[model samples]
Target: MAVKSDFLVIGSGIAGLSFALKAAEAGRVTLVTKMGPEETNTKYAQGGIASVFSDEDDFELHVRDTLEAGAGLCHEDAVRLVVTSGPERVRELIAWGVEFTRSDNAASNGYDLHLEGGHSRKRILHAADITGAAVERAVLAKVAAHPRIKVFDHHMAIDLITRRKLERRRKGKDRCLGAYVYDTKSGDVEVFVAGATLIATGGSGKVYLITSNPDVASGDGVAMAARAGARIANMEFMQFHPTCLFHPPRGKFSDQ
Candidate 1:
């Protein structure tokens, strides 16, 4: 059977959840998560979102820090936009009920940010050690409360359906129409149709024999996107942990 929707968002991470919240306001949204909505790399982020919230800190410094960390491959315009708009976006997160850590009355003045590795200033807005958890929880709660947003957990996407699926060459470059999903619970396949689809599935830390990513982090989105004519960049770039304890006693570390 095929399920239809005005907008479909794959993955329940920060990006997909945020997009779903925005899209649900205008039309129907179906959020498909491979695992539970709360299960994602975003939930394990020990660090936090970088934003220039204090008067002492600004976009220029943030940009410099990001560029330095990005080495030489960071796009200048993208860096500029991200650093410049980061603070407002952080504020938007606050409006979404993400309560970042505050201290020294800084939250009242602006925000009490922290300095992480590769950063020159304390521009990271965090919620203790589990900043990502706080953000994800807030967004997921809102997503659950939204009447127009439908959630499907444990639905793994097998591949995307494009104009090619229709065998229609006249559709030009072949746009994405929907996807083929495997329901983990039902042990069956389902075709989901959507007018618009956004892929927000996070990292591919599982490709490595030793990693710090969830079991579901199998690069599903990257694979599906590449199969759908979308270019997959940064495949060679990955995080490898040499000291990862793979024993059952410490399997949690390898599970990410």
Candidate 2:
């Protein structure tokens, strides 16, 4: 029999963890990952998160900076939405147990903000240099405490289980049912059925031979989605870190 839940989330990165936390409130959530729960691209992120947190900063200014950084490629509406909602999202992170670096001065409102390259103001809230890792650990702890969430680490998602394959109908639009997950340790393939399925796997950064993404960033989600007939777009815009510790011979990154 197929293991089932109300929501099946593939990947245990920040996006996956955050979504699972939200989904668990509504229904049971099954989170699957290809590696250990803590080993993710988020763990390697050394910078801080940017948001409008100071009196000197505002939503419009942040949006302008982001748009300028995007070089006319960013969608105005999406940029506006994220910029306007960033502070609340940061607050949500705080409420979920994320502890950012605190400001020593009483006037800075307790959280210390930094100025990054593109931003015009000091709006970056971080836990020292390991902001992403700190956020991940805190949220993952919350997820672990949530009774409705079940995390399956070392389980790789091979493909999406769409409605056409399971229900025996191939003519209409294919709705996703769940996925076929592989147990990396036991070499067993199993089915995970769910009412809603989400793939929050990080980008295909390792393909460049040198990236900040972890070893699990091998594009499993993109490949699975493409095989499941999802529209693949904007792949040309894949982010590449300009700087990395490049190791010669076979692997570009030292960790790999």
User: Which candidate's lDDT is highest?
Assistant: 2
For candidate 2, write residues 1-256 as lDDT tens digits: 5889999999888899999999998999999998889988888778888898887778999999999999989999999999999999999999989999998755456789988998988889999999989999999999888999999999999989887767767578789989999999999999999999999998777677666677778888999999877889888887665775666646444455
lDDT of 2: 0.88
| Local accuracy by lDDT, each model | 0.85, 0.88
If scored against the real structure, what TM-score would every candidate get? 0.92, 0.93
Regions of model 2 farther than 4 Å from truth: 105-107, 165-171, 249-256
**Clash pairs, model 2 backbone:** none
Question: TM-score of predicted model 2?
Answer: 0.93
Give stretches of model 1 more than 4 Å off. 106-110, 168-171, 240-254
Model 1 lDDT tens row, 19-133: 9999998999998998888999999888888887777777888889888877798899999988888867887899999999877755435556787778877778889889989
**Span of 10 residues, lowest total lDDT, candidate 2:** 247-256
For each of the candidates, the C-alpha root-mean-square deviation to the true structure, in angstroms, is: 2.5, 2.1
